[model samples]
Target: MTINSAHRFEPGATVVRRDIFGDRVWTAAPRRVIEDRGDTLTLAHWPGVEGLAPTTYIDSLGMDSPAARDAARDQGFADLASGAWELGSWRWRDTTVLSRFQAGEHFSVHLFFGAGHRPLHWYINFELPFRRTALGIDTRDLLLDLLVEPDLSAHTWKDEDEYAQGRRLGIIDDALHAQVELARERALELLAERQETFPTSWLNWQPATDWPLPELPSFNGV
Candidate 1:
């Protein structure tokens, strides 16, 4: 059940990702709205949530060698930065996440869950503040993230190299880079102060078992 409401989209509405570069439709992953408190919007992502992905990412998953996969993983982000990849399907497999976005905030806190719906940790996704689009929201991921322990005892910055690459490729401009730095501090402060945004009670949060998976539209065979 939702606490406060803003009615941006009804529960189970699809949210498309609008690219920061021009008006290109980069990705669209359909998610069910969990709550909408005007200030904060929550969306649920479950397994089989299909959306756009770099083809190299799909290819890496099947590689037999760990080194090869790692190399491919690195290349995938490079491909994304260069706009040299095809649009491929990416499914959220074997996990769940509740993404909470606050208006004008440069970061979104994503609560991750594992098997049996156990709260695993929080993923602080540093990105551009969402601009409402016709489909849902328009925000570009900054290629950097922070992973916080479930208990808030520890945190780590993830994908720093990729983020640096983003800077080199001009994907993240000077202004956006400064914004990310500020957002990083804000995320740490929230974690350090044990803010309500990262509620501990939600460690066991799970949706109704009967709820069906959200469907991804084909965009007329994109």
Candidate 2:
């Protein structure tokens, strides 16, 4: 069941942060990726490099499905933002959480549907820091072949018309609200489970719709 009842978010930038070990972890991952003929002209995930494949990452999303493979092809090469995927033919969920604490960069967890829109691939992304040690096997990377291939973002809204742009922008705001509510609920649950998890990471989530681009540096970074 897609949380259709939740407010629809305007497509744009959203800033969310969670505290980790007294350090404030801000999300700096880019939300947009422009690709032209296999060449990403803007915001390269693996910047300063050309056509470099993903060598040390994993895709939690199952890539075995033909449809998933096709979608991956369309996305080009960018870090898998988060966990976004469809479950069977009726459910779809994808989330990307970029943390400077985890890897001094970004990491994601995605879950999506396959050919029939059913649960075909459900996974995560672990953008580990350069010098961080690998602990347990992260399932996010194993599903999407992230190690061998770099992930890419989508520039679908670049040429959108004014009305379409407005709509897209609106989605981003809605998404922020949804994220906040979701996070709050989860945080509470976690707190109940263990008080040690207190002082849960808190972030000032503000979508692009609220203010000018410059005012929100969190959204502008990544």
Best by TM-score: 1
What's the distance in Å from true for residue 136, model 2? 26
Candidate 1 lDDT at 71 equals: 91
C-alpha-based local distance difference test score of model 2: 0.25
Tens digits of per-residue lDDT for model 2, 42-147: 1112111111122211132456676766455334222222222211111113322112222222233223223333332322232221221111111111111121
Number of the top-ranking candidate, with lDDT as the measure: 1
Stretches of candidate 2 off by over 4 Å are: 1-100, 103-124, 130-204, 208-222
TM-score of each: 0.88, 0.20
Tell me how candidate 1 scores on lDDT: 0.77
Which whole-number lDDT from 0 to 100 does residue 12 have in model 1? 59
Per-residue error (Å), model 2, residue 76: 7.2
